[model samples]
Target: MLKDSFGRVATDLRVSLTDRCNLRCSYCMPPEGLQWLPKPELLTADEIMRLVTIGVERLGITEVRYTGGEPLLRRELVEIVQRTAALTPRPQVSLTTNGIGLERLAAPLAEAGLDRVNVSLDTLDRDVFIRLAHRDRLADVLSGLEAAHRAGLAPVKVNTVLMRGVNDHEAAALLRYGMKHGYQQRFIEQMPLDAQHGWKREDMVTADEILAMLGKEFDLTPADPRERGSAPAELFLVDGGPYRVGVIGSVTRPFCGACDRVRLTADGQIRNCLFAREESDLRTALRSGASDEELAERWKAAVRGKRPGHGIDDPTFLQPSRPMSAIGG
Candidate 1:
């Protein structure tokens, strides 16, 4: 297991399979379609698989999560999951998808050893959905969620980025929908980080306010943060029922101190933080004939420079040049 200067061990790795997505949520990609990573510059399936293997062995990466502009966009996704699942000690394999291609891919993904799905569904109302997603098919997303449930993707988590004027008001409704459908709906703060030039401070809805809104409808109590990843969400149990609500405090609060995740772009650069402009290129090392041990050392060296936190906490901190869709959030 590799340990960083912060004494944090890399237990989880978020791999972006592709830097392409279908949806353009305002908080994520804004109204305009954002710039995309050049196709040739992105990592190929084999290269990503090799890195995953190294991450599991050398970085103490116990869980592998496939993320993307939309992970499903990569045709080799199922195969990638299959390969990662075969590793010794068998890391917990999971994925975060847009759910557009989920209807057709969920079952295949689960059978190949995918353990969970984090579906991005901001609104239940069709008009609101289109306005938020820049797409007209709310039905498609719901169908995909239903299909995921049927495919044995249990505890299916819904990721709703709550913006003040946009989907923030629908918090209770979204939670109700989750409770009825057995989904673990998480309301993420419309953080300063987005695909646009800047994240409006006033546009955000804090975790406390969102919790109050849901507390009005359900008897909510805080629960422990889930697993080894980022605690973007505050987990809560609703009364005595089965479902729960999670709130991500990326904006009002940041959790970079305990952040164990190492994000690998679909191509082969490793980013220490979401807001970091500098990245270490690993694909070059792989292509330049770096051996497994050499590559592992490179991974270790890159991880040591991990900052204690992100600059988002500072008022003068500028948003990264690229948006969420391109960054594989």
Candidate 2:
């Protein structure tokens, strides 16, 4: 098991397929975009599978989420999911994507054994979408969401980042839309992960603010806390019934104590924490003919050094050098 000194065992692995994204979301990157990782630097499909196999079989990884600047842009995504699903004691496989091309790939991805998907959609209005994403593909994203639903991706999650003076006013409407479409709406507090390093604490919409906005339109009671487990989102029963919404207060609530996730960069570096400044180089070890056991030990060592928390509230807090795009969501 990948146990850290803090007694947190990592069972969820987030792997970055690429650092290249189609949409230039204002929160994520500049319109010109940062330089993407070179093709040779990216782990091949076989390499990703090998690392995942080691993680699942040796390191107790029960869930694997493929992330990227936009994972839908990966050419081998379907094959990767299919192979991951074939593993012995198969781990749950999912993807975090921008939903750009999902309209065409949803059925194929479902058939390829993708268990679920989390699509990043900040606004329902096309003008706002363009302003946020710098793309005029709102219709495509909506179509992708519908396609995923039709393809049987149950509980299709919609991740919304509430930026003050941006799309924050749409919180209620976004939740209402999710409820109507059967999508699980997750409102996330904007963190210090933008490429431009432009995230301001004052500009972020807090979890409390999000709840207040939603509460005006719907009755929200806390969902069973026990059911939350190691999940980042704190769920709430919408209108006191079957449907629920989630709030990921990463900066405010900080669930690091129960965090079970570790990340692998597109180039195969192990990130014990999202805000970690250092990384363990698994790619070098793998390329140098290190055995699986050696690789696993490297991963374990990395996790053992994880800090107790992200420490964003501390005066000494420093934003990670890599943005959310490079570090995989």
In order, the Cα lDDT scores of the candidates are 0.82, 0.93
**Which candidate tops lDDT?**
2
Tens-place lDDT digits, model 2, residues 1-329:
99999899999999999999999999889999899988999999999999999999999999999999898898999999999999978999999988999999999999999999999999998999989888899999999999999999887999999888889999999998999999999999998998899989988899999999999989999999998999999999998879989999999999999999999999999998889988999999999999999999999999899899999999999999999999997
Predicted candidate 1 versus true structure: per-residue lDDT over 1-329, tens digit per residue: 66779888778888888777788877777666767778888888888888999888766899888998899889898999999999987999988987998999999999999999999999999999888888887898899999999999887999987777777788899988988898988888776556666677776788778888888878987665554255566677789645667778876767777777788877788887778777788899899999999989988888888877788767777777756665666
TM-scores for every candidate against the unseen true structure: 0.95, 0.99
- In model 1, how large is the Cα lDDT of residue 222? 68
Model 2 misplaced regions, further than 4 Å? none
Among the numbered candidates, top TM-score falls to 2
**Candidate 2, which ten residues in sequence have the lowest lDDT sum?**
161-170
